[model samples]
Target: MEINKKSQAGSLESSDLMVYVEPFNEIKIEVESSVSSQHTEEIRSLILNELEMRKINGVYVKIQDNGAMNLTIKARLKTALLRGAKNGN
Candidate 1:
């Protein structure tokens, strides 16, 4: 789906995350995490994989992670994507 505007989900609480998404000319994901470099790369990889699976492009995503688990990240990403999509409520 095409991201029509900026949207966000989740929070900055420990063991949680905040996902922000907006329209862009390219796929850009920025992650802010206190985790190790390896884990940060893992987070980026996970978001990339999800966007690929959804065929989502030309959007910018920002993730503020507070030691969140994979499932929580995915959930927040999904919500942000939907909220940012043109057809989303």
Candidate 2:
């Protein structure tokens, strides 16, 4: 799916994360995490997998994590994508 504009989901509270999505020419992901050094790769992989499953492309994703779990990340990503696609933002 194509993201028409910028959109975001989730929160910055403890054990949560915020996800932002925007239209782009290529897929790019930037992640800022409380545990970046230890879990960056894992979190990136999870996000990529989610996008791949939905056949999403040509978008930029930004994630701010505060010790969230995989499920939370997945949900936030999904919510952000849906909102962006629907609202064209």
Please give the CA lDDT of all the candidate structures. 0.93, 0.88
> What TM-score would each prediction reach against the true structure?
0.96, 0.92
Q: How high is the lDDT of residue 49 in model 2?
A: 93
Deviation of model 1 at 58, angstroms? 0.7
lDDT of 2 by residue, 1-89 (tens): 77887899999999999999998888899999997667878999998898898788788999999999999999899999988884433
Which runs in model 1 stand beyond 4 Å of their true positions? none
lDDT of 1 by residue, 1-89 (tens): 78879999999899999999999999999999977778889999999999998888889999999999999999999999999998886
